[model samples]
Target: PTLRTSLPSSSPSLSPTSIPSSSPIYISRSNPTIRKPTLAPVQILYDVTSPKDDIKIYFGKDDNDGREGPPKPHEVATNVLDNSGKKYLNYNDLGSGFTVEVLDKCVIKGARFYPANDREGRDPSSYKIEGGRRRKNGRWRWSTIKSGTIRLPAARIKVTEPKLDPRFPHAEILFENQREFQMYRVTFPTLKDSDSEHSMQIAEVELLGYFTGGGVSLEGVRTTPISSSSLIAESSNPVSQKKRFKSTGTDRAENLQHSFEEKGPNYLLDLTTQYDMVGILKMNGVFKPDHPRYKKLTDKTGAGFISRVKNDALVIKPAIGKTVIRGARFYTSDSEEKYDPSSFVIDGGVEEANGEITWRRIRAGVLNMPSARVDRKTQNIDPELHPHDGVWFNNDEVYDMYRMTFPETKDNSVNYEMRISEIELVGYRSTRKLEESNFNIYDLITTIYFWRYEGSLTVPPCSENVQWRIFDRPIRISPRQQATLEWLIRAYRDPDTCQRATVGRPRRDGTGNVDVVRPTQAIKYDHLQVHCTSANY
Candidate 1:
């Protein structure tokens, strides 16, 4: 858990004028563009520290009925069992630190620190402050805000302002050019004396910032046990029986469709591939040289055919390490008649060796899929469940793709396709901690029964550098809610005239064929591996 401390009650609500003019700072809601913060003393997050057992109380706001009055004394503590009933603010050695993150978007004007009394060499002398903002891809990037050393006060002055000169240690520093930010991380790089190995102690840290009214509100952020939702569901019996196949069969596909449950250890994939020249392999059908629909299927825009149905795409934080995603398979919802066809692409990446992870979209994360004809002859006679209109991509790229289940009608009538506006992307941090996610560990892990086979991208360029892993375990989705994603895959339109790119063309979902599952293709020489919680199944 990230270490955080709140302000104490009984501390007076300060106005900008309280500080000396040398520090010139302002804290007011007079600017309509920047609203006043709804919450106060802001949260403090700690890092790189062990304790020497010392207690310090902060005086600020009270938690009583969530009301803000005067600054009162409050102890900083985590309710964890080891530190239960004890409120000690201690940093074992040097280079220990903490951060203050505003609950909302705000402009930080200035800050002040109050050192703990009686701590001589343990008091922090030099510190570094950084500002951070969230990127479009939902990752944070920090920039240096200020850094300086302060002189320890001798008398018991309630509040003392230290002279901060970037160059005096030597130059002058100020926040005259305040920018909107959501976080300010403060690191105590050095104590009063470099020769001393004593831990640092801080009684209180305060920040002055006005809300920008634009960032995510940390007030509603919470951590609770993951329940049955889009990510995972409770099962009386997770998996019944498991079987393998030297060659694909009806029973194997059936078992893969509904028998297995999402659970167990997660295996990391090597997802460092380049995006271009890469495509997902279509297990059921690869684009054939002589097919009549060849010209349209090979068009630069893969959105031509499936553009009629609203399609949705989601992006999830990949598991730690190199996440090698060769191929993805879908499962039928408990209340659905068929599995919705979708696509996924690697968009961004992060290296976990460093404690911090920053996500960025991979260049070649796009996929191309040629429409596979649903068998019109056997539409109702023999309903084909898993149509082979497989999602194909070239293996030269690395990215994370999240394909959501389309909504189904309550009466099970029409299934909607993808839509541009309806496409959803949920960012995640590769761990089981749900503080920033809607999924749990169980939702990301699955017992996969897979067989590798050499295949070609089912679209144009017909590149054959594809290694496919056809999973037998099905990923479940709620049928009734899946169709809501139909608008995202709507037909392509002319950017200039706003007309359909291909006039009179049938939408991917409009084809009368219900079975899109490609006919069982023969598997070539390749290894078969089943990854699960237990080998017994």
Candidate 2:
């Protein structure tokens, strides 16, 4: 390599180039006119054309030109096209041409000298010293020579694996690069502050240097592709700790500790004293019909109907084994006034009490009968306070409740419970054998007994469990009251368009979905108590 200076000149015969003698070096470039391709290990490409402005090349090993000055354009160009030099390419081999500038050089020819100018004979600024006069010895004359430097930019090296994919070479210029039609410059001041440093002595800085798809080896070589296995290798020490579960000791904790409930309350089920049965009789005002499930809720008539009554009624018979409470009877008692228990009327439908209510073991012989009463008030049998409001149901304004219906007693609006007799459906008052097919007075008497055991008041939070007292007697219901209940079940028409309310399932109402009843809750235990306060005369 040689350090070259220049003599400046201007002539029309030579190509006019704006490249400065102090131009950046492009160590790599290729003669596109030839097919002798250059590789990264041989050359580096650079931009030297100064048509627009100065091209900034940074300082680094890639641009390290050991010559006393920056690499010249000819050297840069020759290096790219040359096959005799080292395989390591310079800027010219990379295909980016270098810029060449013409410089002025002094020539000492015997006493008389000629001006060193371009072929056009024009003197560049360098050829004319700032204040030199024309009287100098001819031997000291200077002339301009075509002088320029080549720039070699930093480049990436890679183990080109084009065989992997000929279309996408393993190592080549990356697509969408800043090097593509973009200006890359290198500027570094290796000495003192800007103005104090010698232009040729500063160490260069790096602007761009890369090797495609390679890792930097400890030996200062980037030659490996990143892979998943090596990336997931963890350090020797544990990276994280596992979490443990927490245990809470409270109500449930205590309960869990208790293995079992050995023994406690033993109920001597006195089926005869079942208060729910009495309450049902009083509510329905009559007997309940027969049912198949016996104790379970089912489609059986005796298991479903309910009742309640007003001051003008009395229970005649609650069905018993289909025998109308089997000789069921009611007597009136007016402790404050003169009253005959037998004379107290029972709507003339109830048969005289033959036997009492009883409970028999599942397999014990024949079942025996025991007396039935409302808190031992069998003698107090009389009219109820709230009679049916003309419908088959009695409205309990205070409780906001209604005993939907009853069956056996040929009654309506009476008891909420079914007599044990209702359950067995063994005995029932003949009542002229009145049935659903007939609206005869018998039909008006006893109603089915059971209740859904739910809440009342078709309103919110509908809290329940109020004791319903329906009479085992059946009474005629006015047609108007039945109509009221019917309205509640079906949809009402919009009076304007006369659009009937779409009943059935909710939503179809043209409004939204809604449930007429509440869902049931699981029950583990229940409690009850009956207090008979002596009535004031």
Candidate 3:
């Protein structure tokens, strides 16, 4: 029986010119080096495919580093080329395999494949050809282009009386629109004869198309290499919290300086004095059993005192760059009864050139303790919930801290309450050298000794992974702001219940000003260091 058709039969014996150099070009979608239509024949060696086959082989390179030349079809399978023995890349147990990015946009007319000589149950019978366009960021976004099956005969020499053995070496798979595209990906969804266990192997693959920019003669077609290192880095740390800051400019520094001078240095308070008061009490009334972790509390105060209240341990996530910060919460010590939530102004600015930094007030608000602990608290804290969250400074040279004051309820009250409010701090440096510098917040701003140490999270599950930062300077807030904070703390209700919790307990004396903070612990063997900074002028 003789088979005849309008389409010409493809054979390995025919000259490469027999196939039109323009319509169907022999291209290794895997390799970007060879762009011509004609390809030198390569052989495939027989071997079992492994699950760990590097998909990068399809890109025409031998390894991830591209140190070695492209693999010969017979030497080993770097990608899914099906030409020779021991050189075929395999699909995993699931028949899905690899994809390759093309160098330029082309109008793909059809495709051809040269199966390996030892093809048995391992040939791909049906599969999909996908195409993609390159985005501005140099990534190819892919979509399915065509779907078809292997219609050409297997690689076998035919037997005819006059030595008419038609070489069944190439399978011609046609495409729909000759659409232009920059990327192509192939996937073998199924195998021949309902066999799922065998992996697909192809010795040589060819795509028939012309460049879309002009024509076949167009020179200097641009190509972008898919960076392997960037892909690896992204996969390793997807959501890194470390932030860095950059300097802005120095023009606004003078106006800010004038504003600070008018306010005066008395506006700032040193919170270390409050800690000294706790030292005098010998931590008698500080430890409360009703705290989140009652067993962790100790009699000591200042540094090492662990209490049941989760807030005692110094835990913070630093936002160094343009990080957005949401809201804030307040906590108090057990001995502090006159303390109330405080209101203050928040200023944000960028560091500028020549030691001149400019700042402007961004937010004016108050911070309050939560009325409902269980209903408001979440197991995992997301630091990005606020709007002002990200890195603000280019480096760690000059940093900003929020200062708050809790004034006692009385006329002309000299006795006041103070503590550092927890911030959604991120990008904190674990190790750094410190030196005193003439960096001033304002003429009104006072420079104070700041300490950095490790503490536990002051909440339930009391995790001891907090790095605490305490600044010596505290900003001033008016009495009216303090009163507003008191009302908010006492009146604020649990969103879930729509009602405020009872405040008549022993520690909470219905004044709406209870100690929400973790009791100060004594500094044991941990080494402590103080650092200071001021304007360079």
lDDT of 1: 0.32
lDDT of 1 by residue, 424-491 (tens): 11122132334565667664434445555667665445465777776556544422123222322234
- Cα TM-score per model: 0.25, 0.12, 0.25
Candidates' C-alpha lDDT: 0.32, 0.21, 0.34
Worst 10 residues of 1 by lDDT: 16-25
How high a TM-score does candidate 1 get?
0.25
| Better-scoring candidate (TM-score), 1 or 2 | 1
For residue 385, model 2's alpha carbon misses the true position, in angstroms, by 66
* Residue-level lDDT tens digits of model 3 in 1-537: 011112223443222112211111111212312223332221111111122222343322222222333334543443233222233535341244455544334445566555554544556677677777778999878777777777435653221212111133567665445345555676666556424333455554555543332111111221111111111101001122111112225533333233223322222111111101121101122322223222111111111122222112221112222222222223223323333233332333343444332332222222333222211122212222211111111112222322122222211145343332222221222223386988875634434555567666665555666777776665444333454565565566778998875342224343335443566765656534445445312
**Sorted by TM-score, highest first, which candidate order results?**
3, 1, 2
Model 1 Cα displacement at 315 (Å)?
Answer: 41
Model 2 ranges with Cα > 4 A deviation? 1-458, 468-488, 492-515, 527-537
Q: Write the per-residue lDDT of candidate 2 for residues 475-532, one digit (tens) a residue.
A: 4343334434544555556678977654434634332233454455454245232332
